[model samples]
Target: MEYQAAPARLSTLDANFEHDFAQRLHWSADTDAAIEQRVADILADVQKRGDAAVLEYTARFDGLQVDGMTALELTQAELKAAFDSLGDEQRDALTAAAQRVRTYHEAQKRASGESWSYRDADGTLLGQKVTPLDRVGIYVPGGKAAYPSSVLMNAIPAHVAGVQEIIMVVPTPRGEKNALVLAAAYVAGVTRGFTIGGAQAVAALAYGTATIPKVDKITGPGNAYVASAKKRVFGTVGIDMIAGPSEILVLADGSTPPDWVAMDLFSQAEHDELAQSILLCPDADYIAAVQREIDRLLPEMPRRAIIAKSLSDRGALILTRDMQEACAISNRIAPEHLEVSSSNPHQWEPLLRHAGAIFLGAYTSESLGDYCAGPNHVLPTSGTARFSSPLGVYDFQKRSSLIEVSEQGAQSLGRIASVLAHGEGLQGHARAAEMRLK
Candidate 1:
């Protein structure tokens, strides 16, 4: 089938630009009510029945009939065998990507994932104690595609943060296991592996099954069922984020090749039909060139139909008044992946404040960041980048405030606490503080 992708073309000077732009950026993260209720049922059932529920769901949903959870479990020996079974090229690439991700996360851990305290003049020690989670469950999507990269992006950071156990859960529909995924689990230091998925896997992770052991937190992306389960189970166990459709926004200055920008847009659009890819450029001719390139290159893509629908539905090619205006619009969008495909990306990068991750120059494509470029591919989507952040070592670790008040410090602090406690009408709190005072 022939596929054509013509993203909406809008000029910033137009009177209806705001309305048109708003319409293009609109994407609802609301899950279907039916899915929510079904997920709730599944979570409750798994929470109640434990391994029996997990086994039933694995057979019913994944078509993998196992005798018990033990049969569904991937042994460490299996993971190593998968790693050994890979070709030299696959093994080499996986090793290289894992090393880069590990190195970047190690630096991130050192920069922020450490405990520190300081003593004041009164010998009052105050700071924070940063610690890794005891264990974490990483959900890798194994339905339509195998995401070895997802395994690396999610588990490697937790390992770097000193997480002792990284439990991995991937849905293997029809009992077909992806070797690369198993190899990635070996490479990423996954402590346990389960060939199960959907809300059932999430439930098992969130509320410990008899076999699968509960985790302190769960990370990684999954389908809508998994997402709904995560949203529901947030209070019981921590989740990375409730991710939406993928997004990429390009701020161009007309200097870089339009084909590169077009392909970069395709990179995100190919993720799914709802994924968004937009380009904001000051030059009208450059925008036209990108459109031509998108048309020319999209036909060559295997997922051209998906790319076409995504670009037609949510994508835009806006003609900005200038690069400054482009940067402002990029900030407003706060896309999951922002690419400054310009001559001097750094100049505009400073002006751009909100983005999950910024790709700094024409050479830096969003795909590079998605795979081997060190930084995490898991990012806040659907304008959540305005306040949230990309997944990192910090997500896998938590901090506790450290405070040790000396006698002199306590005397000063006690009076202040007593006054505040009394002001708040908490007599017990006030009395407790007064009791500590000299």
Candidate 2:
């Protein structure tokens, strides 16, 4: 079958540009009703039946049937063996990437994950005590593809945060485990790993089965079922985010090679049909050149069918009035990945207000960040970047405000609290403050 790739074209000067642009940036993270219901039922079953339900669902969905829960768990020795089994090149790359990730998160921890306190004139000591979670479960998606990088991205930060135990779950459908995934777990300091995924894994992590210990939080990307399960169990446990499809927006000054820009768009498009890739530039000729490159290079990709459908359906080559306008549009999209593909990226970088991650310069590709650029690749999607931020050491650790009031401090604070408590008509609360007064 012949492959054809054509992306939608838009011009900022068009009369309907506002409406057209709004339509392009729209995407909902909401799951289908059927999927939500199925996830709820599975979660309830796992909550009630525990390991038995997990085994049953793993057998039905993953086609890996095992009598005991022990069979599903992978030991540290097995993970080490997987790491040792890799060729020199694979091991070198994995080690280098993991080190970079760890280094980055360690720096982040020192910067923001430390406890701090201050004392007032009245000897009122107040501050925040930062502490890591006792245990965390990281879900690594194994179906359709293997994400060794995800293991590094999710686990390394938690380890840096001083998390005591990191439990990983990755589905090995048909009992086929990806060596690199296990190797990543070994390198990233995952305390334990289980070959289980889907909503059942999430449920087990949230509710704690006979074998799988309940975690304080669950992090990582997953399919519809996993996302729905995470949403349902949010209060019971912390989740990273309900991530939407991958997206990348490139703001070009028409300085980089057209092929480079085209490939950057393809990087995100290859993820799935819903993935969005857009190019915004002032040069009409450059936009045309990039379109030509997209058509020329897409046929050579292994996932050409997906790339084709994604580009045809959601991708766009937008001609903006200028670089400033391009940045404005990029901010509005608040894309998961934004590439300032220009010589003077810094000149325009200050203008970008919202983006999951900003890839600067022509050489900085979004793929680099996805694999080994050090900053976390688990970013907020679906315009959530407008309010949230990338996952980091802060996500795995919590902060508690410390207040130690001196006798003199309590008298001042108590009077303020007593007046407010009385105004709210809570006699017990006002009396409690009065009791603390000097």
Candidate 3:
């Protein structure tokens, strides 16, 4: 099939630019009502029936029939076997990527995941205690594609955060497992694993089955059903984020090769038909060059059809007034992955404020960050980067405020508390504070 990718061409100077921009950026996160209802049923059944529900759903959804939950579990020895079965090159690459992810998360832990306390003049101590969750479930998407990278990105941070147990769940459709994914689990120190996925796997992790231990949190991206399950079980068990389709916004200054930028855009567009790739450049000629490259290069890609559909549906090649205006628009978009494809990326980086991850310089592609660049690739998608952050050591750990009130400090604190309590007409609260006062 001859694939064509013609992303919407728009200019910042266009009269209806705002309307067109909004339309391009619009992607509703609403899950189908029927899916939501089905997910609820699954979650409730899993909570009520435990292992039996999980097994039944696994068989129905994944076509992997198992008599008992034990058959579904991926034992530690099996994970090791998967790791050892790999060729030297694959094994070496997995190990190297794991090490880099571990190193980056370790540094992140040191920087922010530490306990600290301070004492005031009155001898009152106040601080925070940082502690990791005892157990966490990291879901690896096994459908459509096997993400060994997702395994690394989700599990390494929890391992670095001192999470004691990392339970992994990946669907093995028709009883087939991805060796690379299992190898990643072994390399990332997954404590337990199950070849069960979909809403049932999420329920098993969140509520716990007879065989699957409950997890404090669940992290990783999945399909619509998985996403709906996570959203439903948020209060019961923590989730990473309800991720949307992948996105890449390139802020180019026309200094980088148009082919490189075009391929970079393709890197994201090839993920799925719904994925978006946009380019913002001031030079109209450079934008033309990029489109030409996209035309020439689309046919060579194995996933050319998907790339073509994605670009045609959601992608854009926007012409901004200048680099500064491009940066402003990028902040507005708050893209999941922002690539500053410029000669001096640092010059425009300060002007940029919101992105899940920023890839600086012409050579720094978003794909590098996805696999071996050492930063967590589980990022906030669909403009959630405006307020949210990439997954890190901090996500696996929580903080508790520590307070030690001295006798001297209680006198001052008591009076203030007493006034507020009395003002609120709480006699019990006022008396409690008074009793504490010396």
**For each predicted model, how many residue pairs clash, with residues at least 3 apart or on different chains?**
0, 0, 0
Q: Write the per-residue lDDT of candidate 2 for residues 1-438, one digit (tens) a residue.
A: 667778889999999988988887777777899999999999999999999999999999999999989999999999999999999999999999999999999999999999999999999999999999999999999979999999999999999999999999999999999999999999999999999999999999999999999999999999999999999999999999998999999999999999999999999999999999999999999999999999899879999999999988888999999999999988888889999999999999999999999999999999999999899999989889999999999999999999999999999999999999999999999999999876
Runs in model 3 deviating more than 4 A are: none
Name every residue pair that clashes in candidate 3.
none
Each prediction's whole-model lDDT (CA): 0.95, 0.95, 0.96
| TM-score of model 1 (CA atoms) | 0.99
Clashing pairs in 2: none
Instruction: Please rank every candidate by lDDT, starting with the best.
Output: 3, 2, 1
Q: How accurate is candidate 3 locally (lDDT)?
A: 0.96
Q: Candidate 2 overall Cα lDDT vs. reference?
A: 0.95
The sequence of per-residue lDDT tens digits that candidate 3 reaches over residues 127-146 is 99999999999999997889
Tens-digit lDDT track for model 1 on 72-188? Answer: 899999999999999999999999999999999999988988999999999999999998899999999998999999999999999999999999999999999999999999999
TM-score of each: 0.99, 0.99, 0.99
